[model samples]
Target chain A: MSGEGWVAVVGTGPAGPEWLTPETAGILEQATDLVGYGPYLDRVAAGHQRRHASDNREELARAGHALDLAAEGAKVAVVSGGDPGVFAMGAAVLEAVDRDTAGRWRDVEVTVHPGVSAMQAAAARLGAPLGADFCAISLSDNLKPLAVVERRVRLAAEAGLVMALYNPASRARPWQLGRVLEVLGEVHPPQTPVIFATAAGRGDQERLTVTTLAEADPARADMRTLVLVGIPATRVLQRPDGTLRVYTPRYYEEAE
Target chain B: MSGEGWVAVVGTGPAGPEWLTPETAGILEQATDLVGYGPYLDRVAAGHQRRHASDNREELARAGHALDLAAEGAKVAVVSGGDPGVFAMGAAVLEAVDRDTAGRWRDVEVTVHPGVSAMQAAAARLGAPLGADFCAISLSDNLKPLAVVERRVRLAAEAGLVMALYNPASRARPWQLGRVLEVLGEVHPPQTPVIFATAAGRGDQERLTVTTLAEADPARADMRTLVLVGIPATRVLQRPDGTLRVYTPRYYEEAE
Candidate 1:
């Protein structure tokens, strides 16, 4: 093959297919091969496309494989949960392409398709915790040093930006989130709102936990959870029916 | 009309209707009243829904009106461009609810549906400039002080976070983006990549400008543009076809 094929790195969004953009859905339908982690691949219904499943830890290898397939004239779709550009397969594939010393995939075209990210879906579920200035940091130290994560978390907290933490905790790195919480508590008030959203937009599996920094438990978060820590201005409102909503106001109160 | 109605704040994404999520599309279809800024409301087609268009500066009024309609048994969709939860109408509506001192709208239920944000769309277009830890700061100072914006911009830059600047410039606030650029230039090297993407995901109107900190001009951006400034680790690669892609590596090299 003359590398006539192309690769589309697509995000299926979070939860269900209903959150998928029409553009992404159409691209999924036209792909010759679908490549992604097993669970994310499960979101897309099996069709005429060939499925390529891999473990999440093997992002580089999977990206290379997708590139190889595309170079061989196969239209490959690298599926990612949430927006592919945000700590997902989009960068991994781009990294692979950058490291292709021989330029074997030089002629293969690559494109990125955006989707509703996990933080976005989670924020939507909880009203608008990320309505103003915000920063997203993945607490998992699998790729970067824990120190770098800690430094970034502290700076984001100090800046008073609403913080959305991805991969908050997992079996492999349980203590990282606790340490992050410690860093956040040092800068924000004890009453600052903390929200833990699991499987948001995923139907019945969706669960939202709202608490304050003084009472937030890191143990409540896992790999599937997205944790949002609010700035001092973040507010929690209670509806008439007892449901709760959290959002940061757009206008910041510069000290009276 | 016993205040039994509900409000759904829906994001139509950046440009076209194709970027609309199925869930948001369904909400738009079911809403009896569609309320938003004139341009954003134009993205949704005419239907049985009553349209209420307002000026861009009237976000709070538009939100209050939507709430009022919903309280009157109208299934209202408050439309926003890109993810409503991100520097959009989501916070405005929630602010309106928060200020309902008399609790007149207590019975009204509100929900948010996330969509691809402008920064995410722009990142996708540029091949993942936000691949790692990132922060979004709105450069418009209409609601906040310039000193605050500058401080946050400085903190985000010093922390080495990829920065996405929303509302980079407008006719009334043209100098704010220039000030932000000056702050960024102080912290980052001259070679830092600065991208100004306007109308991303919108067909013919979409335009992308890529330059370095030394060459970037604030005049290149407008309110419609989303600007992305890369971290020191950010790299730009040129493909054989003469196109450019920028991405930040997931792993940071700790000081040697």
Candidate 2:
């Protein structure tokens, strides 16, 4: 099950088939099997002739199965949104490959394709708000402890860095991001701009209101939502249509 | 020449035709005229049925031409690589439309189709080095002033932030990135990780040796290079093959 096998960890992009890059799309189209989280697997186009193993909690096992299929001379893709290595299945797949096949897996050509991360998608929606110094943290304590998350948040805020919060909250960990906000409040001003971007690039995609840090409601966020907390220098400019765009001035030369 | 017309600023992804998302591809396929920097236009599929205006120095003029074509009832797509808003023509087009067309272009709907930015491409090559806090700055002062660029660099480095420096250096501005390094050296340790990722995703793409801040050679960098400077906490891990990867410790949970 571990001979002549290779795995392509592909990013399905932030949302929808339209956002999928040609390289990623080509890999998916050529794969004989697709393995990923249940929701992410559902996002791949159906034109690809492939079998799929979609399980939310069985990532490790699914990775093993995909490697097995690849060993059988089948092209395999382990799909993840954005870049797989960025808080996704890339490290897991590599670890699984290493453990299952030992150093033998090194001979197999493994390629990790990049995708548009939710942070980038959120920044685009917010008018280059991430153009300044920023940090990204995943608030989910499922893998790590809340204390670690808090420390990073506190450090970033105290250092006047913008932050992008992933996995801010879900059904089971609904208060994780809220706790994070509480910790951040100690270091940042209450008027700091906070952007809630949900389901970025998906059908129900919505860029929620940018409010002051004290006003952000974590309950309104979900697994698909990305929270961006700006530093003191971040500003929200309101448009005539009542929508607001957030940006951190990077101070460019005055236009001649 | 701008009544009831629309413009779509599309991203052509990192490579050839396959990298173009379906939405962007569809827009380009339907466009009567495509406008962008010279190299980007050449990358579009040869069979593309559109007149193209490829000029680097004439971005604003090309954008105006695209708007004129759109006003004449021909759908127009002003294309850029990666996301148009990042450091591309999308913002320029919008700004020009705002200034030149005013109310006349109000009815003109404009949509920005996102693409894979070079930073994401660089991150993928380096194995998620950008997973933590980061900022992006363009060192080219052609359209922007050097003072503005210096301010952002100083702020980002002082915050111990990872930074993605685009347009690092070129034939005429060979010493820009060196000056940036000088500023960064004052704030960050001399041993910080610096990655020079050039021609990412192309056949000739080269992922340079990631070295410490004190050892990086800016002379080897160019406009096509995307330079990543890691923060204090960022560490370069050695793979079995001795290839390096960068990761910022989020410190998840404290080991209880």
DockQ top scorer: 1
Determine the TM-score of chain B of model 1: 0.96
Interface Cα RMSD of candidate 2:
4.4
Residue A116, model 2: lDDT of: 71
Candidate 1 deviates by what RMSD?
1.9
Give the C-alpha miss distance for residue B162 in model 1, angstroms: 0.4
Clashing pairs in 2: A22-B18, A22-B19, A135-B133, A145-B253, A253-B145
- Residue A9 of model 1 has an lDDT of 95
Superposing every Cα of model 2 onto the true structure, what RMSD results? Answer: 4.9
Model 1: lDDT of residue A48 = 86
lDDT of 1 by residue, A8-114 (tens): 99999988988899999888888899999999999995678999999888889999999999989999999999999998999999999999999999889999989
- lDDT for B179 (candidate 2): 81
Candidate 2 residues B1-256, lDDT tens each?
2344567887777666655677787777766667777688887745555757576666667777787777677777788887775667666665555456355544455656677777777767766566544566666556455665666677666544568887787456667788888888887878888888887767666656688889998887866788989876666665566666565543331311
Q: Name model 1 segments beyond 4 Å from true.
A: A1-3, B1-4
**Candidate that scores best on TM-score:** 1
- What's the distance in Å from true for residue A247, model 1? 0.7
Write candidate 2's Cα lDDT for A109-149 as tens digits. Answer: 55677877777777666565665445666665465656656
Candidate 1 lDDT (Cα, whole model)? Answer: 0.88
